[model samples]
Target: MPPVPTDATTSTLANSPAASLATSQGSRLAQRLQDLGPLLGLILLCIAGWVLNPDFATAANVLNVLTRTAFIGIIAVGMTFVIIAGGIDLSVGSMAALIAGAMILLMNAIGTAIESAYLVVTLGIVFALLLGALFGLAHGLLITKGRIEPFIVTLGTLGIFRAYLTYFANGGAITLDNAVSDVYSPVYYGSLLGLPIPIWVFLLTALIGGLVLNRTRYGRYVQAIGSNEQVARYAAVEVDRIKMLTYVVLGICVGIATVLYVPRLGSASPTTGLLWELEAIASVIVGGTALKGGEGRISGTVIGAILLSVISNILNLTSIISVYLNAAVQGIVIIIVAFLQRSRR
Candidate 1:
């Protein structure tokens, strides 16, 4: 018989190069699985959807689902940057409502001064983008300059934004001018190469967002800051500025999504964009982004957004559960994903 191994021999084996290599390989494999998790989930969900309702696979149904997804998908792209940079913004839904209300009011007011519906629409779009940037800048300044926590800041603004919109509307809906609505409807309803304009916009936004996150210096800085803010600063990164820009990017995305959304409903109310913050945040986490920040991918976010939309579509098509419980499902997804993140850690 071979000599019984001693404690020292066992310890030596554990510390050997082969053991290290094995550990490294295991880690890499786990990481790849985590990265593919969202995509795989999406495929499985689609299969289930098809099985539940053969109508789910039709071209019209698929396009309709995607068109509906554009608003949240666009916003989720920006949320990806914010989460990767170790920040959160709960005010996005309320911000969109306020922006939509303001856009309608502005367009209505301007229609009287300008006979050109196109010119009025152009002004409304510009106003929406500028206002979004301004709001984002305010959030950044308060967080960076005022040295406040992002959660607290955005939470306060969430209430404030919605309250302002409510007050402006006098607790009612703000409807778009009919003529302007007709002109702007195409932004949401029109199709290009057999795809909805909103879908096209979503694709373009994702493409640009992916490029910015993967191929640019700013993206690296955002990741470094999220990984370790103090270490990033020590490494000569402008941590505050990068963090600020991430919020600005998110705000711009909110603006773009709102521009697309307003035309669909032709109105903004207290109910407008309800629980969108939940959906947006859920999408980012589901896409494999770390809740604690430091690591993420835009592609994952895009898939996550699509996956959530698909889930909602499936539910609607199959009545697997009440349509009213859609938000509940998303909340559950966030909780599950968060738990998984903690377990992985």
Candidate 2:
């Protein structure tokens, strides 16, 4: 047998610069793997989809998956900011429903007075965006000024929003006028360069969101707040304002999505945006954003949204599992990702 090493030798080796460098390198490699995990999983999922159903690879089907992903994908981009700043907004779905209903009502009511369908649609779009911003502002104020938890504030607004929409619709659907809808349908159905408008819009939103998150001082402030609010305050980061603005961004995203969605179905009802919160949050988490906040990527969120949409599309195309189980799959995915995040921590 070889001679046993003494404590001095072992301790010297452990304390050496080479050992420290190796440890640091190992940590970086592990972090790199974690960052790429979601993208790799997305690619594997796509391959599995194609293997299960050749149609999954078709251009038409691909566009359809992306088009469907636009709404939640846009919302998930906003959610990336909120989550990175350590905030949550459960009211987005209900808020969308209210905005949709109000927009349709505004367009229809204005159409009766204004002869220009184009003008009516423009006003409605503006109304949707403004309402979204205002709603987001309210959430921010409530959380920051009123000193309430983000979860509790959003949960309360979620119920209030949906209830008001239901009351406005009288427990029925709020259908857009045919004339206004005809002019508006292109927002959802129209294509440019053979790609759906919604998809293009989704890409633009993701691009802007990525820039804001990674490039700006505001982005750094948001991350700092999420990492440690008290520390960030001590650093003069204006934690409350940044946190509030995050909600406003999320609200604006919801509004943009609603504007696109109205033309597709031409109606909003109690069930208009059911379970959207689940999908948005799931997309953010699935994209590799930490549930505890302070860490996330916009690119990861886009990939996560597409990945979830692909899973749903595959389920719809294949009989291996019922499409009804799609939500179940998403829930399970969130749980698995959350567990993985915890393990990493």
**Candidate 1 structure, TM-score to reference:** 0.89
lDDT of 1 at 200: 97
- Residue-wise C-alpha lDDT for candidate 2, range 19-120, written one tens digit per residue: 233246456576667677778777877898999999999999999999999999998999899998889999999999999999999999999999999999
> What would the per-residue lDDT of candidate 1 be over residues 120-235, giving only the tens digit for each residue?
99999999988888888899989998999999999999999999999999999999989999999999999999999999999999999988876676876777677677767877
Model 1, residue 182: distance off in Å is 0.6
Which sections of candidate 1 miss by over 4 Å? 1-25, 320-343
- In TM-score terms, candidate 2 sits at 0.90
lDDT of 1: 0.85
Q: Best candidate per TM-score, number?
A: 2
**Overall lDDT per candidate, in order of appearance:** 0.85, 0.85
Clashes of each: 0, 0
Q: What local lDDT does model 2 show for residue 330? A: 57
